[model samples]
Target chain A: MYGNAYIDPNEVNKTHSVLADEDPKLLAEFEARIERGEKIEPKDWMPKEYRKQLIRMIEQHGHSEIIGALPEGTWITRAPGFKRKLALMAKVQDEVGHAQLLYSAAETLGKSREAMINDLITGKSKYSNVFNYPAFTWADACIIAWLIDAGAIINQVANAKGSYGPYCRALDRICTEESFHLKYGHDNVVTLATGTPVQRKMVQEALNRWWPPIMHFFGPSDKISSHTEILMKWKVKMATNDDMRQQFLNMYVPKIWDLGLTVPDANLKKNETTGKWEYTEPDWDEFKRVINGGGPCNAERLAVRRNAEERGRWVREALKAGQTAYVVPFA
Target chain B: MNVAAIKELLYKVADDQLVIGHRNSEWTGLGPILEEDIAFSSMAQDKLGHAQGCYQILHDLGEANPDQIAFSRKADQFHNCQFVELPNGEYDFSLMRHFLYDHADQIRFEMFANSSFEPLAKLAKKVKGEIKYHVFHGNTWINKLSTANEVSKIRMQTALNESWNYALGIFEAGNFEAELKNEGIFEGENALQNKWLEVVCPLLEKAGLTIPEKSSWEPVLGGRKGYHLAHLEALVAEMSEVFQIDPTATW
Candidate 1:
């Protein structure tokens, strides 16, 4: 469910505003810890920008998980057999649970889960845009479970090496579970691709439909994207958008071809000389539009989440009625 | 042992689990609390897996595979009591139904654990272990929410009232009910129903909710004979929507 959190091309340029109010001595100490690969814990001193950026990154990851569950979750009832049903249920449950873990992780930095969720529903925060597109068929779900999760593991594995204690730990656990999801997804896609002609066509079409979104998943390349040198120095941003995308393509494209499913883009091939993938450029305009809420399922996805929030309000209220105090648990 | 009797018993048990499990799963991301969401999804997975376990027994007795039997059956061919097919209206209704139906199912499985039929007894025994948690979850929620607030109590009572008749249909006797009882394949529905009432009445009373009177109870029937409510057709269609795409595919 994780796609890179799309950075606004402008926000990166304004990050220095964080240290304008900080004691230069404390800022130097914070940088020294990050430079030495020490984890920045909750009680640790941090520049305002470090807290803000980590919260943004982790909260977006959490939102992606929950919203990501919706598209695949819809397939649980209709999954072809008991094996798929049980696995899909467990998989989607893991996604929601991941959101819980990640929200808690983000909470360690001082933002409340309620406030993070509020920003999500209000569109003040962004999740991976891949979810804003529909899972149009069973094969689409299969592709997501396999390919999108593949992308997440790529991004998350790199992020697990990050300097934040909680988010890194959460990513480690998340990657372990996502590995199984990758297996389940791969099994499903293999089944469809090797099935009857009708099924083969279905999976191929699904790949075709999803390939563009997958290409757009890691966000725009650094050459055309925001500069995040400060966050990188903090180890908060572990890999650039292009690096994660290439890692995904490098690992998955061959496996996708081995399944005998064609990549939708004719130009998709690895370069022997450059040792990198060469593919048609993902349309940044569409990525921008979708990330800004123009995709087919963006409205529907948020509305479903918003409706769940509204309908579930009374039960949440009733459960809270007798509780004398509320505490946000540590991640 | 009457094979038809055993198959009949299995169908109702398996169908109820599958249908209700499917309904319970609808709460996955939508539950009021995160813990409740995880709880409902876990229970849903257990119920569905239990349904599959029941179908494996049928497959040994020469039915189609579990997927085909489950996904290919027409709505009217389903043997689940209508109580389960009713949509999850709200958490109150869902929680109430879980409490009532699972109490009966728990006792039913407990009774079956001693069945003369060994395959069934084995499945029932294993299933009873999982149903323990289900009944516990149901009981805890009913107990907690019953006195939680005025609104919760009203909602719980109304859902209990609305669901009572369809719930009774869970005990509608099979055609081989007498033969099964004679062979000890299962205790008769009448006996199960009596025991179910004895167990449930105390909990309802403790929760300060009314038990619908026997004379007023018009137990809705025919679901055991493959009749169902309208909602069931739509549920079945949705369940098969993707599977029907390529019936022969491995997916």
Candidate 2:
């Protein structure tokens, strides 16, 4: 499962650059269509900015899936029994399939899958930072399947109402598949929670390890700016970072407590007055550091991806040798 | 029905499926392409499920449960051929092994579809359908890569040469071979090997890959009698790492 699309809070003009040269009439018409709740298809008249931002968002989202498969994929061999092994394999496969779909959606905005992959391997792009942390144990994998995917579903359910036609359609399908992931994850977690002392301790420790990354999942709250405003108006961003995170907390914190598990944050609870969950602020410093390639698994993750690309070069080259020029796949 | 012979037959196939399924799953996130990654995982799941199915049959015949039988065995106690226990050296080797192994696997299931053992015959009918797609996938890739270009063709050939003997080891006969045959519980390993050769040889030939000369056709043996390569031991340890934590606990 994926986190929300991570736009650098610092990349201000890069998001706003298309407004300077576009025809006002066309821009107005495009915004008007989105305002009327209509999707902006690939061939539709759009401001260059919309296409650029959508490409970045969708590409990063796709990259998240590809990288996300790595940590849990490692556990497929060591999963406790046939039931978990089969479930985890199919779940990780769905993550890869989600990458394919998202990549196709991004390709509709003009980036090729190869180009996106190159960016990912070269560390020129970003995926969900939670993946850069290790899945140190089977319990860790379960926490990811349950809580991380729980966050993704909240993020994705909001994004499914997004204005990009292909992305929305893809999210709709992805969300449906994610339901199974959520249930599978929850089942594993429940099994562990209600299980022996060893299992309970394992799941609790895993929860402690993952709580920080889970908090950073929706990303830091958006700074109010015209760029954010325009994207919101365009329906490109269906929800704010803080809003999605709050939705996650409001829905899940109680369930986590019911399991007799402690939230790593002692202050984690709902404010009966404001109706918003309150907690210690996550370390945005660590989030920024990890996103910038300083996390424990970043180098290893990229190295593995790059190695895969290098080893498969011949296969890809052999397939492409006499083929026609690449055509954008159907979204 | 000679239950001993049928149980022996089931053990070998189940062990092969479980071991190879474990090997193929190592490609979960590391395949040559995302599609191939997903494909191998899909096949891995199928193989694992098939292994579980066989173990379930064994369980019905008064053996331990599937989990105990699968996850509790030591490497030397397994019946899988040494071929499937080897590392996935590269995409080429893995693909080559897949093409070679799946063909033999499909034919074995097809032959068992008419077994006098009712449960074995029933499972064979269902599993044969799935193995057919596996063979089809292997064939499609072998045909494509073996003829794609010089580099791909040579890689495919080298992998084929290195893998041929081990592939032949897949049909290593068990002690129950004669009884299984006489009881009609199986067609016997010799018949299975001949039929596998008949299918794979022409396909490899059509793909422009050369079969090793008959003078060099010594099959690697002993896995059927419980000896295995160093790899299987480590693989078994790693595979059982979590289960062994508390085998009595429901994971």
**Best by the TM-score measure:** 2
> All models, DockQ values?
0.70, 0.83
Task: Classify candidate 2 by CAPRI docking class.
Answer: high
TM-score, predicted candidate 2 vs. hidden true structure: 0.98
DockQ of 1: 0.70
How high is the TM-score of chain B in model 2?
0.99
- Write down the RMSD of all candidates, one decimal each: 1.4, 1.2
The digit string of per-residue lDDT tens for model 1 on B163-214 reads 8888898899889888998898888899999999999889998988887777
Candidate 2 local Cα displacement, residue B85, angstroms: 0.7
Q: Model 2 chain B: which ten-residue window has the lowest total lDDT?
A: B1-10
Q: CA lDDT, every prediction? A: 0.89, 0.91
lDDT: which candidate is best?
A: 2
Docking class of 1: medium
Q: Which stretches in model 1 have alpha-carbon errors above 4 Å? A: B213-215
Q: What digit string (tens of lDDT, one per residue) describes model 2 on residues B128-160?
A: 999989999999999999999999999999999
Model 2, range A1-331, lDDT digits (tens) per residue? 9987777656645656658798989888988888898998999998877888899889999989989999999899999899999999999999999999999999999999999999999998899999999999999999999999999999999999989999999999999999999999999999999998999999999999999999999998555322477778888889988899999999889999999999999888899999998899888888889999999999999999999889988888778767988787887
